[model samples]
Target: MNENNGITLSIQKKKINDDDDDDDLTGCFKRLKKRKNRKVKKKEEEEDEEEESRRDIDNLV
Candidate 1:
């Protein structure tokens, strides 16, 4: 009975560690996704400005 209890306790501790690791991984991914979104937005805005400039040049011509 004592051995069984010890094994169960170890399993619980392992599960706790696994959970913590999962949480950290999720947080890291969230940060990466947020940064990627910001980069995409900035690129889109730059493209828009480039298009506007091209249109203005065409009008001038």
Candidate 2:
């Protein structure tokens, strides 16, 4: 790469790293990874809710 590309990359990296909330960068990364996890689809979530509601009804009965 050219010298300009190196300089620009360094400047962008510094800007991104300078945020005080950089402390939460790891948490942000974890949340992003969880968002990408394929096991959590809407239908599964709905089914879990239905199961929970059924359990509640059984307990009440």
Candidate 3:
């Protein structure tokens, strides 16, 4: 029937919208993860540089 077809189309549209929202959320999470990883990597690099400086000082002394 036409009524049933209309209902089915509405449901399909809603499902598509929901899928888009999920994709947006997934993208946000991915960006946050990348930012966190970059911060961690930068901190590690800074620590390594500090360690090297200490070693140089120790050698000089």
Query: What are the lDDT scores of the predictions, listed in order?
Result: 1.00, 0.84, 1.00
> TM-scores of the models, in the given order?
0.75, 0.36, 0.86
What TM-score does prediction 1 earn?
0.75
RMSD (CA, angstroms), candidate 1: 1.9
Index of the highest-TM-score prediction:
3
Per-model clash counts, in order, read 0, 0, 0
What does the lDDT read for residue 1 in candidate 3? 100
lDDT of 2 at 47: 94
Summarize candidate 3's per-residue lDDT along 1-61 as a digit string, tens digits: 9999999999999999999999999999999999999999999999999999999999999
Model 2 TM-score, all chains together: 0.36
Error of 3 at 17 (Å): 0.6
Q: How many residue pairs of model 1 clash at the backbone? A: 0
Candidate 1, lDDT over the whole model:
1.00
The residue-by-residue lDDT of candidate 2 on 1-61, one tens digit each, is 6999999999988887776467688779888888877456766888999999999999999
